[model samples]
Target: MNLELLESFGQNYPEEADGTLDCISMALTCTFNSWSRDGHKLVSASTDNIVSQWDVLSGDCDQRFRFPSPILKVQYHPRDQNKVLVCPMKSAPVMLTLSDSKHVVLP
Candidate 1:
């Protein structure tokens, strides 16, 4: 599938110099981890220890979650949409709730 850029937002923080906010002395630090569900919504985890939920059609971030460590991978539950699994680079996968953005490590 082909995708086009619509809008851009700063990762981790809204007022950061991510080229979208501060264009004078910019720093493009946010990188994509390639995690998507169909073509409607996607989850992007950056090196800033942040996971962002995106709306494919509108190119808007619907929600944001801050993890304890930098997120390595993100996956949605097979049977549950509200529950997501986020794996940090130095640790195991943790359960994340989409409603409140609460994350709990699985034992």
Candidate 2:
């Protein structure tokens, strides 16, 4: 997979970044979910009850969150860079604060 970073983005991303995102080693296995507001990070959610954050430049997973249920989607908060909203298959949506690893279920 080639990830093309638009020139307008003004990042040092190579014109043609090759290979699947390291966040999800096997792209076919997990959902390539969300990117951070700054485009510096990636989040992947999988049926294996895992959520992972990866560094875009290094392609290294920086953090991992595990839940009891499979996650359908993971979205980064629009304004809070350290927070993410997670939607699970069989439970209420959750708000995760990366700074402190707090898990709060949304009402």
Candidate 3:
């Protein structure tokens, strides 16, 4: 695994920096689902049981949603740009509708 350490300036710097910590233990998994209609937002999830909408251009976490169990997988809807499917390890998968109001329970 090629682990790159980011600098304080949030840029990729040399590995042999003056004071760089070599070890990190944060349990997180992330993947991009799809781009928003406005081309500004991206949907991503982590093992920490959190789903977040990120800004692709600015590289910022814009919105977050917490699940009851650790998120196992996440994917975007093919036809509708605003919908996503989230699968948790312990529970049934859920379909989240993008207007941020409706959720469909799936088996």
| Index of the highest-lDDT prediction | 2
- All candidates: CA RMSD in angstroms? 15.0, 13.5, 11.2
Clashing pairs in 1: none
What would the per-residue lDDT of candidate 2 be over residues 1-107, giving only the tens digit for each residue?
Answer: 44564335665776785877457474547864898899998888976789998899998998899889888889999988799999998899999998888899999
Tens digit per residue, CA lDDT, model 1, 1-107: 43434445545465656565446764535555434446577777877788888878898998888877877778777666676788887787898888787888887
Top TM-score prediction, candidate number: 2
**Candidate 2 structure lDDT:** 0.86
Q: What is the lDDT of every predicted structure here? A: 0.74, 0.86, 0.76
Candidate no. 2 TM-score = 0.70
Model 3 per-residue lDDT tens digits across residues 1-107: 53453325476678786886665787565743656666777888776778887778999986678888887777767667678888888889999886764789897
Name the weakest run of 10 consecutive residues (lDDT summed) in model 1.
1-10
- Model 1 RMSD, rounded to 1 decimal: 15.0
How many residue pairs in model 1 have overlapping backbones?
0
| Better model by lDDT: candidate 1 vs candidate 2 | 2
